[model samples]
Target: MPHADTLTVVHHDDTKTRYTDVRYQLIRDGIRIWSREGEHSLTDILMTHAYRRREQKH
Candidate 1:
C-alpha cells in the first residue's frame, strides 16, 4: 500500500464547468496515479479508483 500521506486526492478544475469536466486525481508520492474526466456521480468515485488500480497492475 502507498504511504498514508501519499494517497492524496485533488480535484483540478479551472472553469465554472468543473461539474462538467470533473477531473478527480489520485496522487501518490507527488505523482498522479489515477484520474478521470467528465461529470461523475459520487458513487462512481469508488468504482473509478478500483478500475484504475486494476489497470495499473497490468
Candidate 2:
C-alpha cells in the first residue's frame, strides 16, 4: 500500500469528459510501487499492495 505521505496527481482533459491520467509518487521510505496512467478505481489501488508484495520477492 502507498504510504499516507504519497503524492498523487490526477489530470483531466480540456473536455472534462473523464480522467485522462493519474500520476502517483511515493514520498517515503520505499520506491514508488505503482504509477499508472489512464482511468483507475479503488480496487486498483487496493490491488497495488499485492503487486508490491510480488515485487518485493524479486
For all candidates in order, the CA lDDT equals: 0.28, 0.30
In angstroms, what RMSD does candidate 1 have relative to the true structure?
A: 12.1
Clashes of each: 0, 0
**lDDT of residue 4 for candidate 1:** 25
TM-score winner: 2
lDDT of 2: 0.30
- Residue 4 in model 2: shift from native, Å? 4.2
List of clashing residue pairs for candidate 2: none
User: What does candidate 1's lDDT look like per residue over 1-58, in tens digits?
Assistant: 2322222233234211112222344433233232244323332122222212333554
TM-score (C-alpha, index-matched) for candidate 2: 0.16
Which residue runs does candidate 2 get wrong by more than 4 Å?
4-6, 14-58
Cα lDDT of model 2 by residue, 21-52, tens digit: 23334443322333345323332231121112
Residue pairs that clash (backbone atoms under 3 angstroms), model 1: none
List the lowest-lDDT window of 10 residues for candidate 2: 44-53
TM-score per candidate:
0.15, 0.16
